[model samples]
Target chain A: MQTGSLEHISDNNGPIIEVQDLVKKFGSFVANDHLNFTVSRGEIFGFLGANGAGKTTAMRILCGLSSPTSGNATIAGFNVYTQTEKIKRNIGYMSQKFSLYDDLTVWENFRFYGGIYGLKTEKIRERTEELLGRLGLQGEKNKILKEIPLGWKQKLAFSVAVIHQPKIVFLDEPTGGVDPITRRQFWEMIHETAKEGITVFVTTHYMDEAEYCDRVSIMVDGKIVALDTPLKLKETYRAASMEDVFLKLARAK
Target chain B: MLLPGSGSATLEGYDVVKDFRKIRDILGYMPGKFSLYQDLTVEENLRFFAGIFKTTPEANYDLVKEIYSQIEPFKTRRAGKLSGGMKQKLALSCALIHKPEVLILDEPTTGVDAVSRKEFWDMLDRLKRKGITILVSTPYMDEAMRCDRVALIQAGKIMDINTPEGIIKNFSSRLWSVRTNDTYELLLDLRRFKATRSAFLFGQHIHLTLVDNAGSEPEIRKFLEDCGHQSVEIEETRPTIEDCFMDLMKG
Candidate 1:
């Protein structure tokens, strides 16, 4: 079956992410070994693998949160090791257990993050209103963070991550326990963000979610064993779906 | 482990060392975090859980042989910093050290990758064939179908408990998938129709649940045309487990 190609790709003048021979270790244990991959601008790149497969390690290195033991990664024309501060400025990250103060209201959390990022109060208010409005959360500005449902908190987390409008966003399992309908809505928002020229790098355990990525890389025992579109990964492994392909590779090792 | 409304006072017919503790034996419990002492090696962690149940890994060596092989390389690593999947495997090994009759896992695959998630389930299948009672919980609907029996819970309430197929069979309507050039308009129009009970977007199509099943294809087509819908494709289909869960929630 032919899948329609994704449009509005942020001009592919150069690769947004480039990694070669990435290696990380703690004492004698190698967390990542000779990892290699590249993600183009405006693409939803999935970093997939089994638990403990070193996917997170590789992501941390690229995001400049951790230094690689060896090898190299460049993001948006900046070296992860040497230009770590610059990379942090141009990246938005939402961790698995993202914190939004329960005591704070929706707009309050937005303003807090904007202040931390040094946005002018006028810009913060303007962007905060525009973003919450876009997410249909205008009326929810005063609602306490703890009172909102899990689905809405997830959307709000994404909105907070991008309040500064970074060039790339890294979402670590952004929809882990959400319902199916809510997940679909979340992906629609992801597509909208990508359309605005932001790269999305997501890590997820849902195989069906892998199908939505522009391209995906599967890590196994600290190595990049497969990298391609979801359809191509299935074809290369002679599996019916991304799940089957994942099982076939993961079990073999 | 007090279940509200169960009316049972306390667990009976089990010994702490014999039957009560036996429940902990044979059963594997892998928490999201490997909870083993960071200062302790993997072998020490396994030995410690075994000691708690008054058994050694060697006592159940034959049963744990296969699992040992899977994690042999990381035996010396500290549990605190083990990889995500390794911690999972080690925890399972510890939980099953005493050979319990039933295993209870609370969201074992929550933080794992897609591949590890599948592998973890495969391991469960292996354990199930050994006649071990495996009771697992997950919030993912896809994982729900894999369980022999599932209890769907929300807000501390048990919504339903049954086989996956049984839950889907209990769905309360004739589900119809309707696709058109304009989904937003179709949703608005369908919601206004008396024949439609509920209409929600599922992927590229809008799933419309008929209220009374009185409308035929031509009748629905005419209704849509009158509502200004164009080139609509409609098909009747069985409900998925998710659909059934949604219905249960709505009811």
Candidate 2:
């Protein structure tokens, strides 16, 4: 329970993400066990845990992509279970795996994803053009996604994930295998997105990236063992960096 | 021990190209990126690896037993079908199938999850306890701390090699962490500052170096204030491996 809030809780308008005693199970095996926390609007909340620490399970439940065995959660003011479709419309999803269709051209991928989000034809075209220009992919707009470099493709996947301008976004290890340089740039993009008033919930194994978060929750097994701002966690653990803070918590019990 | 497109290298006091078989006999290598045959089961892969070292699996069963036991439950399952962690254990078992004294792992935990990544390192520690020389490389700087010593590399060039503590201690710069309402703009402002030596993005703060100016802190504070940054705070900070790596890369 060594902790500080992601932000000083002064607004009291309710968290954009609220999970209360959340639980998920595969028969007798518990994936997420009575997890409780809230993510503020436009905040970069880093969800961290070991591979099987229930980070993914909780995120899946939050994204309305899956159901929990019990407990309650709400995202963007919508219930995760009863208001999934409504929740889905408020948040974008991106993962390490490029979500763009490899066989489709860059424009096609953007157009298709933009269409799914109910963007008007004119809006989709405008966003696609803007996205292409922003990514410096104007020359590669017609090229199939498979033809682009992995770095560029990852950026496109992220852009398309947020193409419809959701109120919040969930990034599951978005730059998992990217090099240091590209990873930094990707985070800058995240900052830009947050600047635009979109909350970002990111789960990552890279500790350096975890430092970029406003606050981080490090889960162990099926429970959240440590939660705080990266600097605070480091101080609490008497560690120099987030990686050590993570290692300290991960090895604590 | 091997570098691409180079002349024959020496390993364990033997020429890699000239003493191929001799070198192979005493070296244990787990490639950075690897795949086990989808059609081969656990035992089958071990048998194949044993053959590569010109030995029977039974001869070195004891050496691989510890790691193999973890994956033994899925012995009949295809190697390709194992979970990432299990697959890594299996790969390690295969590499150790011949009881080579020297173990070389290239990013063995690259894609493994956090828990399994720790487990893998624990296993390496056990191997080290048994007098094995373990050589490992990982992109994660944090993992570098677990080692007895480390070398910093950037763009195929070696920056420095020292114990993790040594590298941090040797970072010769006045590093500071600057936090403000807008970190992105803070970085841009610092980067544009004349006295700024190097500026790196570190979580919520910018890790910066000053160009030996007496009023550097106040000057930086003034610059951020001019940029209209709110709640700005700047303080000297200890450098992490990532910070040092960024600094080293600039050189």
Candidate 3:
């Protein structure tokens, strides 16, 4: 009966992400409604929600890409309103597209993103070699992005995003269309990065990924309805899986 | 639709190479990608497909009424501008427009959202109840449990063909639920264990496949505890469809 993580984490300490009643409105439509949550340092936080459930809006606010209509949020100790540039420098992002230049070779793409992040030439080369070796792509330096397998490209995208050694990395549904093998490989990379003390804030449709998170928050119609570890959330909802819990919460409203 | 092989294949009791024409009549094939006329409106695309089948949309109105009602509001909108879920509904509606006895959907939920994917499967269940023989192919192992019977195919070879539960029944290897606070370290530690065959995160727990039978639990559990993980709990767990598929793939 001694379940370590089966209990909800209400202690709320070491907050890397702090949101206070965050609200976003486009015209009269509220995309985010008084959202509140916290992500601890070095935690893989899973942001779960149905389509158009304001997950993107809240993420935009955290990334300092968009201004909230009301309330507030802080990322890496920088205020979302005023310290956006500082916040941007400290955070990494990998979208669904992976955002790599298909025409460029692996090294060329890495060099381009490295220069954009203001990394020195020597630092870029060092990180490039280290990353390629770590990903088992050391021999693929000269290959074009499009020619490489999708799983490899995704890994490269993730490496490029964190090339500047950001404090936090935001991944928005990175493993959506991949098979189970690739997904496991991708999650291994996530675990490796999280081990290095970089915070991973990810949003995913797959319930299996939700289980990988240190903690998760489910958004429903622009609000944080459930925020707990996967085990605790499943226990609270009396559901077998996160998908079932999502359906139960998503349908209850 | 055509898989090349050394020998001939069969389709619905007919030889695929010999009865291609006859097989096409009963098959309502929907390509994974939405392959409708992008410039055409929703109604226009449906009408076009209906025409190809030598029937008017009005003649098959009852057949597609259930699905069409969901996407009818966007009847005038171009197919290219529709959302992912709407596109899926439209594609399904068009596929039903032919009134074929068999429906073959090739991973219809590939790039769709979770809610839409669930809805798509629900639609399939309804169609199945109408006495349609549905053959759905998905790359998602988690969906294997949803079907009455599944064929595990890899590289043009059939691994196993049986009910979902039957496939799991054949997973002779013991699987474990290894839970710890630090997954990264836990993975690294588990990988170093002698008896550990495979360790991967599933949901919140690391699903470990032991190399031998029931002999490695205590040793692996002790190893985890020795790594300074206080709440490490390793328990014998049942294999899921994905676990069975993974075990099958290893051979």
The most accurate candidate by TM-score is 3
The top-ranked prediction according to DockQ is 3
Error at A20, model 3, angstroms: 3.6
Report the lDDT tens digits of candidate 2 across residue range A138-206. Answer: 899899988887778888988998899997899998887665556777887887787677889998888
Docking class of 2: acceptable
Model 1 lDDT tens row, A133-219: 888989999999999988889999999998999889999899887777677677777767876788999998788777767788888
Residue-level lDDT of model 3, residues A145-252, one tens digit each, is 889977788889999988998989999988876767778888888877876778899998888778788778998889889998888989999999888888888767
Q: What is the C-alpha lDDT of each candidate?
A: 0.79, 0.82, 0.83
**Interface RMSD score of each model:** 4.8, 5.0, 4.1
Q: lDDT of model 1 at residue A107?
A: 85
> B1-251 in candidate 1: lDDT tens per residue?
22345443222345434354444444466564447677888899889988988889899776666776688788888888676667777888888888876777877877776666766788889888887788787767777888888887766789999999999888868888887755545766888988887776554467788777668777778899998877779999888787787777666
Q: How far in Å is the alpha carbon of A40 misplaced in model 1?
A: 3.6
Per-residue lDDT of model 2, residues B1-251, tens digit only: 44458756677888876787787788899987676676899889988989988898789887777888988989989887776677788889988888898898988987666666878888899899887888898867768889999887766788999999999998888788988866777877888888888777776678888886344677888988988877889999888877777778777
How close is chain A of candidate 1 to the true chain A, as a TM-score?
Answer: 0.95
Cα lDDT of model 3 by residue, B54-141, tens digit: 8888997887888899989999999998867788889988888878888988888775656767877887888888888989988777
TM-score of each: 0.80, 0.80, 0.88
RMSD of 1: 4.8
TM-scores, chain B, all models: 0.78, 0.89, 0.94
